[model samples]
Target: MVHRKHNRVDGKGRIVIPVKIRQAMGIEPGSMIEFDYMARRHQLVIRAVTETDQRAHNRET
Candidate 1:
């Protein structure tokens, strides 16, 4: 399920992800996240790197 929430970056460049969005994405404290900045599109992508993803990534390395 995809969820969207509007957030503003603080002075220190930190943005708080809404609680509902976090829960929907299975994100919790200490979870690892990957951030990608699409310069061409001027967009930022945030993704959670779960254990399964890490395992797959390790195998590819």
Candidate 2:
């Protein structure tokens, strides 16, 4: 269980994920992240890594 500190978006609309969490999640510099809004709940999300990520995982494994 990897625990991380949370950071809120600043007035300039920037949020920083902690370095440890970013490393654990495999987020890299210049990587593009997509966001989605759930139609039912009307909640926003940063999409989780998907099948392509699975392929990458397989390669590493």
Candidate 3:
């Protein structure tokens, strides 16, 4: 199932990720967010960076 929340962008074009999503994804303050845009499908995939993601990124750097 696709869980969803509603947030609107301000004049500066910022969309607030809801608290529910943040807590569910283990995203804390100062956490980094990532996005992947599928141009063909016009879809955006957003994810919170986890420890595993950080480890993999650290390896690349």
Candidate 4:
């Protein structure tokens, strides 16, 4: 499924995720999301993060 939404970033660089997208992704108030920025495409990508993802990221660093 595709969820499309647009929201303004606050002065602190925080953007509000849409309720529909949140619900679909099972995101709670404190859920962690991963963000990837593609400078060439000028787009930002976001995805829900899991414990396994955290472990792999830690290993990489």
> How many residue pairs clash per model?
0, 0, 0, 0
Q: Which stretches of candidate 1 lie over 4 Å from their true place?
A: 56-61
- Candidate achieving the largest lDDT: 1
Question: TM-score of each candidate?
Answer: 0.80, 0.53, 0.80, 0.79
**Model 2 poorest ten-residue lDDT run:** 45-54
What residue pairs clash in candidate 2, if any at all? none
Off by over 4 Å in 4: none
Two-way TM-score contest, 1 vs 4, winner: 1
lDDT, candidate 2, 1-61, per-residue tens: 7554768999999988677766766777765566798999998666446668768877999
lDDT of 4 at 27: 82
How high a TM-score does candidate 4 get? Answer: 0.79
Estimate the lDDT of model 1.
0.91
Q: Quick one: ranking by lDDT, best first?
A: 1, 4, 3, 2
Q: Write the per-residue lDDT of candidate 1 for residues 1-61, one digit (tens) a residue.
A: 7677788999999999899988888899999899999999999898989999999989999
Q: Give the TM-score of candidate 1.
A: 0.80
| lDDT agreement with native, every candidate | 0.91, 0.72, 0.85, 0.90
The candidate 1 region of ten consecutive residues with least summed lDDT is: 1-10
For model 4, residues 1-61, the per-residue Cα lDDT tens digits are 9888778999999989899999999888888898899999999888899878889999999
C-alpha RMSD (angstroms) for model 2: 6.6
Evaluated against the true structure, the overall lDDT of model 3 is: 0.85
